[model samples]
Target: MNKSFPAIFALALFLSVLLFNYAAAQSTVQERIKQVENNLTENLQTNDAGPMNLQKRMEHYKVNGLSIAVIKDYKIDWVKAYGVADAASKIPVTDQTLFQAASISKSLNAVGVMKLFKSKHLDLFADINTYLSSWKFPYDSLSKGKKINTANLLSHTAGLSVHGFGGYEPGTPLPSVIQILNGTKPANSGAVRSVFEPGIRQQYSGGGTTITQLMVTDISKERYEKYMSDQVLKPMGMLNSTFAQSPAGLKRGLLATGYDVGGKEVKGKYHIYPEQAPAGLWTNPADLARYIIETQLAYEGRSAKVLDQETTKLRLTPYMNAEAALGVFIEDYNGLKYFGHGGANEGFRSGYYGSLAGGNGLVIMVNSDNGEIIQELINSIATVYDFKGLNKTEKIKLANVSEKDLDSYLGDYQLTPKLVLTITREGKQVYAQATGQSRIEAFAETSSKFFFKVIHANMEFVKDDQGKVTKMIFNQGGRIEAKKL
Candidate 1:
């Protein structure tokens, strides 16, 4: 044979070996995925809340209705609904019961935008200003020439403020979409202005997604909700989901009433998010699971209908310096990497998380303001699956302390620039209330640590340089420091 022919043959042989190794690795992963599915099926059937009384705890924590969906091996193997959808009607919450998915809608909107990316009509990192028609972002002197892209908006790195949209409650005149963007009346939930230069640090801004929605309307010349229905919801078969922004839809009676920590159902107030892309869509756990499965398929290169493999990778990749990726928070929990988003609306809370490595994932939603309870419950269940990177360890262990000492701990503490904690004593017992929240009972877990029986969090008093108790840092959903004010 010629010398060139011999070299080509050697190169082909090396390529064969590499392909063989890759195939073997993929086979091993599939086998592990099957095993995880088996374990989840068994555990869910026999799930009696062993290490912690999860089901009972949900009820005690005033969770009116809850649902869970698990995706394993590219299939939605489990979907379970718990408790009553309507407490008064005694209607059981079934898989079909439509719930306000809240901010979970943002993830779906992000997917819709990615579809535009596949058409080569949208650039994720392009200047958002290029798509604007009605008005441009009022960039400050520092950020006048800076650009905000789809990637920045998705990952919350657009340097915008006002973590998210606050839905319209009853008796409030609904703000127009422009009014919301302008921080006008009825849309005061988030600041209507940018905080820092575009592509700076991570700051949760549903306003960014609102801008995304505006851009979609401007480019497609169609309503945001209609575009989403045609492009994302219909393809995904989310039949029960709706983009309706009226209380009449809610009053039609399939919707679960939002509840507070005390189990008081909230009515006359529903979210009319001008930030439609961020918090507008309402869906069920089943539909949300399907959306998540699509993400998994995209990652594996098995599907490219909505987004190309390269664009999908770019969206999932972190944009800001934070762990939050485009439209979802990405973190290494336990030892496996997970990608999902958490949502909280008026009286409802939901979280969707799954391993990026294709092991398993979970979706949990509760019809209560106390979504932290669901977070704790899911984190506990994840631990059973031996998820390696979960940093959630905050728990409630109540202790009976002398009533007199309660007075000493009673004081106002500041958790953040926005969060304030007020401690009040009644006899030997101490009750705590955060700003804008009703008073709650704080049971002593230890002499130093106390737990909020309603929400899944604990407060521990910290001493200052004088050792006279200057601060009380609360550890619950995450670390939050509260200095005595």
Candidate 2:
């Protein structure tokens, strides 16, 4: 009985240690989640607005639903969903709820195209017309006789027209790819023609991605969605994702209803994207996190489930010194390198970012047109996780200005040939709207200077010697002087 007593004591000690470690790990996860949910920020600053909660931010932004997935150590650390998927039905969003991936679809399309390149089924440098069978690109002198290649198309250096598409509402007549490319009747956008010489610069073109969609169908003799699912998504374990133009079967109920910035539900819930390669993906963040992890692992030469290390490197490499690498954009935050893409459909906005070296990243999807909340949530997660080179916030304070002074700054300013900033006054508030963008309220930092609460942008009203407003210097990404017109 003495020998048995020792064994029993050891078993009890082992169980105690296991339970203690488990409880500690659970507590750590809860703390991380709590920090992320409460620390939302735009510029990581403390102002009158103060620290924001995720639910409050969602309400403030008029976002109806949101899904997020966080990646740590090359795996999905956690995924969370918030708000109602359908306000009318009060259907709550869940981890499985699907949102339009929008332009993130291009990232996966690039992977599938690279798979073909790896199999020797296609060549990256070959003229795109070589693989295209159903239709041919109408090359004009704008192309400078430079034939569009797979690399150009993937990297957005093909000089193609139609930056994006406004998808058809449910039950609306959808245009065929050929019709869309030709800019014919019933097509919502212009032709996908060469706007400049290929390989000169990077211009985002979802139309170019659509051409690849057709190419995949033409060359593989399979539907674009099927090809992508079988070749890239399934192998990477993104089982919940699909490029189907319309949600069907079990996906119907899982789809989140789209909402406008005003919190109004879009008619028919959401638009149908026939251009599957650019804006047609219906997926959740957990599935996208899988793709990010696979990309990280493959780049590290640890996995070749879909793309091998050499091919993944080629896909991530920028073409012609452009900021874009294949379908993803390469950006440096502080000093950390990241490759990711942002997507915006008519009523859906989504974005994802993954580290170039580490397996750390995040994916955010919202069912509202307003994208202001996406970055704020990312900032919160970065802060809580102590991610390198992210969540750098600055303190800012608002200044008091007279209503009469605000009225004087109201006018139209031309920043460029195509860009204009229109400042309007409503009662005591001032709002600024750029051409082709929604109106955003501007709060005064000084009588002549104003800043936006939702975005990292500022405006300074410049006056002439006579104290008359002449021009305004717009500062957001950079400074640009716009003459008051």
Candidate 3:
């Protein structure tokens, strides 16, 4: 027997084992992807909580399109696209299709501001007026004479108003940043003034973020979109991403058209956001995965594509708000930390999260006003990946209420002069439809109390001494009495 025969046999065996392992690993990956697709759960889960198919889930939520990218072991494990870019045009989502980043742009905006601090010596703590040659924040007595800084703007602690923007409809003139800050004509939004003194607490001001948009333009002498494209997005390997309000150079057919909660197409397809820093960005989940991976690597001091280790740490550290860091929000889950942000524009809702350890992350984007699907998808992903403390589904049990009781709660309750909440009973199901919105089913929590799964609100039917329903106490952010008519 030749001695070389034994060696050759050993080598062949090793190669066979390697090939088998690779094939098995790939099979597992496919299984996980299938599980994620087939297991989309509802936030308000019922006792009949069977795992839902992704397409069914999309139909249930009236979402037009969705894009997803999951990161595992510091790399994108998988990327999947679902549904159509536009329901009318029937364009499918390939994920080169761009969706508005919305407020998620603030996350990268923080990176841009920190880059200025690192490279250009812009003081993060100095008065924002120092760098505002184009326009200054009109800090009246509302500011209490305290100065607002770059950090405050990034962390949303500037105490500014204008929670968010409603983008301009088609053919409408876009507002200049100055006009926007002043709430002048064509801006549509109110003046971004101090609602309270600066540095009071965490007030989410896209207005403040817009001010930093100005600061970036003023300091860099470049358009916000161009500067972001050159300095931050490109550097992070997010080649497909842009801060352009109307993203140019994108393929003619790649922009996903917007849709409303009722599945109606946006009149102009999608509104134009001149508020670029706070709301304007057009990118997909794949590009977002690159951004998340780079951030995770930078946090671990293994990479410095856009931010160094020290600056990255500073960016992740909570500023004025415990959960809100510079551009991202940091939440601790049983000692496991994560940083992420969610975004919404006129017809789009998106969210992304990257774990501080283990390099696990997920990005989800949809071209519909309904955000109910996003959280449900996240719950499924969290369960599949065993991401500690990431699932936030609320399983609710329906209370015993007679069909007659539900029907008694039916009536038009005048919430305001022009607004009425019309509660209608269809068969045995109780549905609440606003004046111009779609009907949402309210599950019975008790005899007189009802809760909505789509919207986070509850209503209690107030009965008179005669056991006649007279009013409804609607509690959503605040309690209000709506007299039944």
Candidate 4:
């Protein structure tokens, strides 16, 4: 054989090996995606087998649309979308459809704030009033001689008022950031004032985040949205995200419409959140995966697109609380720590998690008020990928109670002026429907205690000396006592 013939045969063999490896990698990705699609689990499993497939769970939760992105090796392995963007229009959800990030905005806001710290534009431990130009925080006796700092704002340790906001509806005139701070005319929330001594303990304050929003503008001499877009989100390669209260530039049908738990469209499509730092960013799962990937890379000192390795470490470190770090909470699963944040806006629920090591992360967004399915999906993904301790499946057992006992607990329990949890019975099974939420069955675990299968909530029926039901102790994230009304 000629010398040229030997060279040509070697080149052909190299090309064949490359092609075979690429095909094998693609096969692995598709297999993982398929496993996640069919493995959706419930937070509370019952004797009855409900829907487990991805599409069936979406319908079972009455969710109109949802998107997911899984990250591996500091890169997005897959991004998937399911259901409709708008149920009324029958538009299918695509990977590009943006969902409201809600309180998840706080996580990114913390990044922006930390970037300011990195540049020495302002001090995170300095009194926020140092950079605030338009409004001043009213230092009342509630502060107890302590000063509120930007660090406190990010860590929810400032002890400020207003746990969260009820966003304005479409056609309603929006409030300026100053108006929101002062709770002036056109602002629906109360003024952001001190409720207790600063730095004493952790108390959630969306109002405190709004303070940092103004400080950002004051220090940078730029709009909060623009500064974040240019310095934080864009540099991190999150191009499909925005802090616009009204996302005006989006192409038609790119923004997913929000839906209630009952599958009804939210009037005006969605509420307008002018509180950009706390709950205003609109983004999709794929874009959020980039933020997580950047964080993971920077944590390992591998990448520093916006924040250098040192500053990224500061942002992830817990400030005062064990879990409530600067912007995101550090969740310890087994012994591995994962940073995460959850968001809930009107007719929208979303969540994201990034492991401290292994370069592993996942983002999930949904355009429905019912958040029960979101946790269930996380459990399923965590189980498949071995994200230890995130699997929160509690195989619940049902207890049979006498019909008379079940009937005694039937009535409306007034939780708030606007919210009432109504307990009803259909034959022997009891059900509960909270105001503006879908009705869920409340299984009797005991004669007085009942729990829900779709969400991790417990309702313990209380009785008086006469043995008549008087009130209900609703326990989920916290304990709330509601008198039977």
Candidate 5:
């Protein structure tokens, strides 16, 4: 054989090996994705409805678009997107599609604000009014003379009014920070004022988070978005995120349209959140995964990209015997600690859970008002990844019951002084609604027992000696009680 022939044969062999390895790696990733899509479960065994196909569940829940990022060993393993970002345009959601982060904004806002504390520019325990130069907090006797501190505000222990915000429609006039705080005409929410003494209890308040937003703007003397982007977002390598009140210029095209529970598009496609610090974040799950990874690394003292180890520890620590931490919530799931935050703004719902150790985490974003799908997806990822303390689901099977039998369970059962469980029926389907909440369908597990698909709660209709339904027993969170009206 000629010398040229030998050289050509060797080069061909090298190319074949490289191609084979690349194909094998792609196949492995696809297999893992397929596995994750099929197995979704919840913490409670009774809540599991068996192995589920994620695409089918998306159809079942009418979720238009979803994005998820999985973190392994302190880095993002993969990111997946599904459904249409804009149903009208049929634009598919991609790795770059942006969804409203909603209350998840608070988590990052806390980081930016904490940086101030770390730099000794602000005191975590100092009275918030001390740094607030523009507007003063309207304190009253309800405060019990307990001044609201930066830590209390960040932890939602400031006892402020307004649990959350109902973002303004795209065309509606957005309120200024001061206008929102005073609950002025342009503001759709109530005034942000003290409801009770600060640090007394852990009650959620988006209004309190807004106060911190103002504090950042006032103290930094820079726009909230600019300060956050420079100090936190850019530092953490989250280039795809923004706190813009409206989707303008090039960012508008990247935004996923919001959808309601009925599968209808939101009136303006998506709401505009002027409360930037609390609900204005527009980002994708891939970008959020970066935040989670940074948090995990900082907590472990391996990295301080955005926050140092000591500050990260303070951010994750629970306050006032409550699971609520600074902007995020700390939970011990089966012994593994998780720091996370959930966001809901009109037709958008997002959540992220990052392990305090082990560098494991997940971030999910959906452009739908119905959030039941988010948890299911999280369960699937946790199961497929074998995330410690995450898998706790058992299979559940529904029982068939007659429509007439279901009608018998229709009635109002009072649970507490202000809460009532109302059961209703339509054809063969049964539904349950609590006071001040939307109605949810309840699937029959037995003639007298029913379970909710959206939540991990169950109901049992109790009968009297005469075989007539007299009360309804609600079982949830280890509490079982009979309610009769």
Candidate 6:
């Protein structure tokens, strides 16, 4: 009886051991499945795209291709490219394929100036007049005594009239740097003009940066492109990058053809820009990422390789009550703050935003007039990383108002004496149009504050003594004022 009982106990214990092993294996398999699901989910569906299939999602958004570089853990974790480099070329965009960076060139240009600044060759607050020789600003009575400094120019507070330099068509006669600055023939305007006194308001002026190029040229005694190359690009090892204004852009076959909004390829000959400091840079995303990485390192008080710690910190901080610091815009979205720049020229629009903390950076560039598509996707990427609120939301006035109340507010609100915004109603929606401009859809925040999402700005309506809305204010591009027109 004792021997039989012992055998039964051993058999029962063996069966119990097998059941425990089986349960443990099942648990491990379940964990593996969960990890896989998480990875898949992270790759799919952003806030704007909703839950459609990936292929359909890409096509619907008109994104021919996209390249994303993730900068985290103090280094680039990964970089990926999707879609064709040229839709008709049947050539896929690889990690090495180049994309025209457009206005993002300004950020790189800023780095160049800061390099000089770090060496004590350039002063931020010194009068720009000391650096000029060939061409000069018209300098109306308003700006005669006011000194335009390098810091003011870097911050876009130079009070220049032209917001940006116009790129010439490929076949058109290229303007010299002096010609472009003078706004002469073969150029868009005769000369750069001053709309307001320097340092009075924060207005974006790419022409102002041209003055920086001129200053660099005078100080370095080299062509603008040569100076940038020797001081900035070469030191950074930006092998493929070039100042688009350089003759080398033509020889190296580095220039990308500008496109129209409808995807029609432009046939004009390549036009040269003398004003290389504003939007003349031509480089790829990979090289640009290197620039961004250095900035991040500089912020951490680590070795930046180029700019010193003091100058880099000054460039990152807000200058003159503007959202932009130095060449990039300083903004806080969700809980994370970042520094980067956005560029738009001809058919291209690109933006690169990176977090100051250890999250990845996002760079988006498209050769189409579809700024909306890029902006929306950029916002989506931010949201995916849980960046819920950005400076992107439009502010419109009106609170708890019904559809019936929207009619009274459907009139024009003047932004400035020169700029008038007309508000018209189409069904339940309201559209605002500036004089001599196409009407754009305006999103509302409350009842009094409305903002344009197509660009950066907001509109607020002020009421009169009788509770009647008397005036409305539209704020955009660093210019703010009321319009009673």
Relative to the unseen true structure, what is the C-alpha lDDT of residue 445 in candidate 3, on a scale of 0 to 100?
A: 82
Candidate 5 lDDT over 1-485, as tens digits, reads: 69799899999999999999999988987888899888765444443346778898889989999998999889888899999999998999999999999999999999999999999889999899999999999889999888999989888899889999999887788889999999997999999998888888888999999999999998999999899999999999999899977756754458999999888999988888889999999999999999999988898899998789999999999877648999899889667899999999888999999998889999999999988878877778887887766554556666778766677788899888889988888887888998999998887888789888678799998888887888887888876575667
lDDT of 5 at 200: 81
lDDT-sorted candidate list, best first: 4, 3, 2, 5, 1, 6
RMSD to the true structure for each prediction, in A, is 10.8, 3.5, 2.3, 3.1, 3.8, 10.0
Q: How accurate is candidate 1 locally (lDDT)?
A: 0.73
TM-score of 2: 0.89
lDDT of 2 by residue, 177-274 (tens): 88988888678889899999998888889999989888888888998889999999999999988998785687445889999999999998899988
My TM-score estimates for the predictions, one after another, are: 0.76, 0.89, 0.94, 0.90, 0.88, 0.71
Q: Give the TM-score of candidate 1.
A: 0.76
Which sections of candidate 2 miss by over 4 Å? 1-16, 44-49, 397-440, 454-459, 462-485
Q: Which ten residues in a row have the lowest lDDT in candidate 2?
A: 42-51
Pairs that collide in candidate 2 are: 44-393
Worst 10 residues of 4 by lDDT: 42-51
Instruction: Estimate the lDDT of model 3.
Output: 0.90
Prediction 5 global C-alpha lDDT: 0.88
Query: What do the candidate models score in CA lDDT, each in turn?
Result: 0.73, 0.89, 0.90, 0.90, 0.88, 0.67
Query: Residue 200 CA error for candidate 6 (Å)?
Result: 1.5
Model 2 lDDT on a 0 to 1 scale = 0.89
Pairs of colliding residues, candidate 4:
none
Instruction: State the displacement of the C-alpha of residue 310, model 1, in Å, after optimal TM-score superposition.
Output: 1.8
Number of backbone clashes in candidate 2: 1
Error of 1 at 449 (Å): 6.0
**Judged by TM-score, which candidate is best?**
3
